[model samples]
Target chain A: MTLDVLAAGILSGGLYALIGLGISLVFGVLGLMNLAHGELVIAGAYLASLLVVDSGWDPLLALPLAMAGVALIAYPLQRYLLTPLLRGDKSAPLVGTFGLSLLAQALFQGVFGTHPKSLPASYADSGISVLGLRIQTIYLIAFALTTVLCAATHLVLTRTRAGSAVRAASADPATAAVLGINVSTVYAMTFAGAAALAAAGGVLTGVAQSFTPTSGLPLLLTGMAVMALAGIGSVGGVLLAGIALGVLQSASVQLFGGGMRDVVVYLAFFLVLAVRPQGLFRKAATG
Target chain B: MIRSTSRRIHALGAAALLAATAGCAGNASSSSGGKNDDGGPIVIGTSISLSGTTVLNQIRDGYLLAVQKVNAEGGLEVGGKKRKVELKVLDNRSDTNTMVQQVRSLALTDHVVGLLGSCCQQNIDMQGQADALKVPLVMGALPVELLPKGKGYTWDSFQSLADGAKDFYTVAAGAKTDKKTLIVTNNDAQGISTGKLWGATGKKAGFTIAATKAVPTGTTDFSDVIKAGKSSHAQVLIAAMAPPDCFAMWKQMKALAYKPKVAVGVQCAQTPGWGSLGKLGDGTLVQLNWSDTAGLPETNLIVSKYGKKYTNLTDLGSVALGLHEATILLDAIKSAGSTDADAINKALAKSTTVSAQGPVKFVDNKSVTPTFIGQWEGGAIKQVWPAKGGSPLASLTGLG
Candidate 1:
């Protein structure tokens, strides 16, 4: 299709990757599919709105604080509530996270009366021309921010000592614990870190589009799709998969029609899962 | 072999996770539908979208206001006896399936005499439930033209899309534009019908249809649609999608510099949240079912009661709709003089009740309300068309 359309897809994929990164990180580390990840993302948006909408602070100014705020809230949730469930039956954490998602949705509704909200910015509805292609200014900022966050996430996971501890816990929690690694702490940290990423994505999303209490479901599904396409443990793969899903969606809209966009994306997601259960990007099982 | 089995288990677990999350996402639940004992208060039930993405609190308030007024007058006279009305409202959270189930339950289980409608597509879905159970359902907020042909159980009293489109084009005719229009709507039934009806009406009004695209409900990307609009150099834009879709598309349209001289976001830009877009939201046009300047019945009362709660004309219109719908149903019950479903249905067919939105008479299961074209200006919707009891139109500054 057109260069502008392709560029839009790629940029949109950056936000998708940011959303997927959290789900991937959580599933890889805790082996607990956190259903509340989308809520975490939306929680970030609402949190930023407090500063942006109420106090008239810029959305970018509120981004880090929102990230830290959601991460702080998520830390205790994983450590106290979800981590304990992980020690129990396999289905417990899944059900527990689902329940948390419901609880979060209710809390959001209770707090922020069921109206759609957005973070207003000068660039929120502006455009920029890159060479010959026109791009949405918000999407351009979101893409750059997503890329930096994704790269930072990769570096943190691959280069740091905390990353090694995360890998250790992810590989074998029992052995890692025996070797003096605090598996529970690492699990909580990873979940918190993933939540931070989701919050960042949420802030950008709030800047990009309007969101409501129930906006998390579609985002959660998209994040889940990204995780599925990227496989369990690869951060870089999540980025690529997000972009691929974005391009596929754009291409599908071009070829089929806008009505078949989700259908085509989900069909491709299903086919990819059926063919490569591990994922398209993951080379092998980490353990 | 162990690894392969483990892989299968993981896949199955992932599948189950997706299924469970999907199942729980809607958060669909219903409040208890109290028993409707013989000679008890007339139980009128409604499955409304009180919460979720599309909240209709203003309409709900209208329903409550009409019921309160009737109750204040010592209730409706039914079967030679005055009985207080008990409105059983269940929040459907804007889910169609939930709305259908709740409406069915309200009819069969709760055994309500009549039903009140939710907004938009939910109301359309509720029509089927009302028909199957043969419960007389009255609703507003949904355009009259989009009401699907049903078994006469559902009655829609709202603004007609054709009338609104005609009024909009009439307004557009005076504007400086190329007469080329680009239409985009969500691919849902209502959205599709909206696109067709608006397209037909625009063409009739001498506007050329540049392109009409139908995207899904949650679609965030509009590059394809924007490209089409730009390529066609369409000066008039009509989008009938959800609030979120409109928000994104409006932002993207402004960003990509696809400036339509006159943009009317029907169904989408009507939401109160549209104001949140700030300056970017100004100059967009939306159709209104009621305008204060129209001198509708109960205007003073509506303002006295809800003027503080709902300041915008759009919300006031919704409240008037709720009041209009409920008043008609209660009047039908009074005319029938009994709680009998068939009698109420027959009475509703011949209903002529006047409330906040003026006189409403159902002809072919539809009542045409006065349609006014409103423009978003300084975060409030002001009537900008009709040249009578309306302000002068403003240039679209939102895109620039």
Candidate 2:
């Protein structure tokens, strides 16, 4: 395969990593499989489309506002809706998120219409060449941005006091609650934090490619595969798994063909799960 | 033993997940109820997709438009009595199983005289429903070649893929490009037919097929196809797929810096959504099954009535197809003088009527409509072929 093909895969993996980052965090810390994760991502893109397409603003500048908008919506949703359900059955949150996904699809259709919309940027169609290796300009930007976000997220979970509380709550919710930590509030914040990451990924996706209201489901599947590979709770592992998927996808397309992409990637995923259920990048421990 | 069972279980779960998500990813639904406004006695029912990946708003509007005009003329005169027509419509929400159930309920419970077909693969699936229930269904939008052979109940009167391929190849023959071509199509029945017929016809029209890639529906990746196009330096590109697929592929092709001298999008580029791709979607040629300037007998009414919603001729093409299908079925019902399935089926086989797409003659339960070549320009498509009433062909711009 050509260097360009491999380069494209690794670069696009940045967005995939960002998508999986939120999913992994929520699954690991909050223990909620957010099926509505993809909707948050698309919501960010649709909100930004108003600025990019209607207001004629630069997409890079609009990206933060989109993330913030989705995060704001996500915070209230977790606080008012999902947090109550979490107090009872674990399956309640999963079903609620699925319903949220359907509701989001309906809302997007009602507001934005079913037509495919793309956030156009100057660098969206062009690429830069470095030492005879050409890479897509958007993917290159997305990769750098993904690295920054990954580091920032890692710092929040390690250095910050809130991160300590989240770790405590995640380890033992009842004990953490007895120690004066509002475990439910931390859970809501964790969900919001993950949602913001999904929004960032969504904005990047919008600038890179076209999106419809229905685009979220395939993206959700991709994120699920990454989370499965990364084995929840590893921020860095999410990045690695995302890049691995991108490379595998690129290699398969360059080797077998585009039609065999799912077959090849899914088989590799199954193999990875079978061989190492704890994930390829996670630490193994025995009690 | 546990590991082996878990592996088997994982494989089964993965297979089921892929099966569920395959081919039908677009899940947005829009609903529109039908009107039996005239309070007519004859009830014609349809369970077409109102929302989802394959939205048929235009088709639904076309059905209503035809029904409205027919009802205005005191409905169909059946057995020397004027019976007003009432259409019982249900939204299938773009699910094939829902469509099957709704069609059955419409035919057996509601007792409608006939059924109208949905677009693309849904129409193919509905054929079995029509045959099994012994109800006559007139379908459009899907190319005739992709449909099954005449089975007495289903009548297809749409563009012939073979005829469209010849027209597109003849149009491309005049373009300034290398003779090498690349074919990228969806791996569905229609997509396969389009690639095969277009490649075979293109070769006869002096073009060589350099590479061919058949991808699954809902595929957003085009790197493999672009790699082939780049290596072969294929100057002619033919893409036959859905709008979403074309939108994704066109962006990827541009991002990869692979530009064909002449690119034609069959079945995918005709949607009004193609304009949303902006400059990247420009210069793509689309083979149209119907055109406003084709000078058909019903063009005046189609434009004048549906002009507000469908100002662009390209958007009106499929609507005209739906309008003609309903009109043809209505005429067949008029000739039958009864709503009997056997009578309507026989009448439809020999039905001869004119539509917005021009002379509708059901030869072997299939009719060939006039195919027009259109080019994307200025947020709309203009007729670029036939060299008579069509505008002069323009050089393709927007390579990047």
Best lDDT among the predictions, by candidate number: 1
Estimate, for each residue in A1-287, the C-alpha lDDT of model 1 and write its tens digit: 77766888899999999999999999998998989988999999999999999999999999999999999999998887677778766887787788788778878987986768999999998888899888889988988888899888888888899999999999999999999999989999999999999999999999999899989999999999999999989888888889999999998998888999999999989999999988988973232
lDDT of 1: 0.87
Residue pairs that clash (backbone atoms under 3 angstroms), model 1:
B79-B337
Please tell me what DockQ candidate 1 reaches.
0.39
* Tens digit per residue, CA lDDT, model 2, A73-99: 998888867777666555767877887
Error of 1 at A12 (Å): 1.5
The superposed Cα distance between candidate 2 and the true structure at residue B62, in angstroms, equals 0.3
For every model in order, the TM-score on chain A comes to 0.98, 0.96
**Model 2 over residues B1-400: C-alpha lDDT tens digits?**
3454345445545755663464234321222233222334777777788666556778877887788889899889887778777766677778899999988987777777899998878989999999999989989877787778747788888888788888888888888888899999988665776688888998888899999999877676677788789999999899988777887778777777888988888867877767766787778899887777667767888888888987777668767877888998899999898877789888888887887677777877788888899998876888887766688777667554
TM-score of chain A of 1: 0.98
| 10 residues in a row with least lDDT, candidate 2 chain A | A278-287
| Model 1 DockQ class | acceptable
What do the candidate models score in CA lDDT, each in turn? Answer: 0.87, 0.81
